[model samples]
Target: MKALFISLCLSLLMILSSCEGRTGYLDEGQQNTVAMLTDVEWLVVYVDYSISNEQTFDDETNIYSFGRDTKGWTATGSLKDPSIKKDVRYFQWTFTTENYAVIYMAGNSTDGYWMIEKLTPDELWVVITASDPVLYPNQYKTYYKLKARKRQ
Candidate 1:
């Protein structure tokens, strides 16, 4: 009886030790993504619209700040173009449980879901898609891509 109880205790201890650093919710990759996102301000470097074939290369002044509280702000403007007025917009964002690569954003200017194509310490690329001919004129589906780089 003593030997059986000692074996059971050892097994329980091993099981608990295995879960020591586990968050039980977010995996390591997801935690890393969250860390990278809230690390610094990101500057918009490129924008592309699929239906219109419109591409805009930003002057690296359009900034995006993601906070740990899941709130963020975007400062839109061009450093090279004096005619472009600077605009600040606030938004709430969260990753979907079904797919962490997808982010849902709701704000005054941004209201949609965006899929992350690439994410690194210094670069991020995301795409938003809308599929409605009536709403999105020229094409059955419209895709908008935004590329950003971390601000120094």
Candidate 2:
């Protein structure tokens, strides 16, 4: 019994050690793609997804606003359903030094994060990917993948 217990402990340690720590996933070029992601202000081009019933619905409802911080450098933006309420909420987001990035929204804030899975400068498009949040953080949070064109 003691030998079995020791084996279980060793196995658990090995599994945890294998968990990779979070690191920026950007390449040099991809890093440039997001340079302005947290720089200039971004307006809502479209919201690619919304959470409902543990399901993600691609919501192209362009009736929204999203922008990066100019000063404090915090993730700042507001979202609303004009059909319902038009209140913008301030939230925090994380931008990776890597090409891939995420915008975290949780609490009275927003309970989740949005990751930029892909960005194409030539096409002027960004592909964001996120997961549905269930049973809290354990389940993937809602994904608000956004494909936006720089606003002039």
Candidate 3:
């Protein structure tokens, strides 16, 4: 019984320590990256979510922004642009990793997996992957390239 107890304790310690090892890469750059992402509400300028379709916005009027706070991120505007009836006005967002995030939309509908292909204070690039309910055995994948809107 004592031997079994010691083995369990060692196993527990190993598991906890391994988890801590994952955070060693949180340097200044990572903080800056997150800060840049959360700081501004980006405007979508170009998109190529489909294999054949490419979409662009002529002006910032039909645009959206991502504003993140203590709770999480809030994505508003132009959600309908990418696809029909998207009309996503407000939703909660959370990052799964440095390069990936997930969005929780209204009615328990998840927008899908959001991947950050590129990020900068001036430019933000993202790709979202979701399933298509309308099309059986198909998925919805889109890429968006955005730029930070000039502050008025």
Candidate 3 lDDT over 1-152, as tens digits, reads 99999999999999988785646455676667767876765667788858798988774323444555423323334433432223445545655555333332222344555567688898877766764222322566688888775432
Q: Tell me the spans in candidate 2 whose CA falls farther than 4 Å from its real position.
A: 1-27, 39-85, 96-100, 106-108, 121-138, 141-143, 149-152
The residue pairs in collision within model 2 are: 26-98, 26-99, 105-110, 105-112, 106-110, 106-111, 128-145, 130-143, 131-141, 132-140
Global lDDT of model 2: 0.42
Q: State every prediction's TM-score relative to the real structure.
A: 0.63, 0.37, 0.57
The residue pairs in collision within model 3 are 49-142, 49-143
Q: Evaluate all candidate structures by whole-model CA lDDT and list the values in order.
A: 0.67, 0.42, 0.58
Where is the poorest 10-residue window by lDDT in model 3?
99-108
Top-down TM-score ranking: 1, 3, 2
Candidate 2 contains a number of clashing pairs equal to 10
Which candidate's TM-score is highest? 1
* Residue 86 shift from truth in candidate 2, angstroms: 3.4
Top candidate on lDDT is 1
Q: Poorest 10 consecutive residues of model 1 by lDDT?
A: 131-140
Query: Candidate 1 lDDT, tens digit per residue, 82-119?
Result: 34435889999888643477777788787666667788
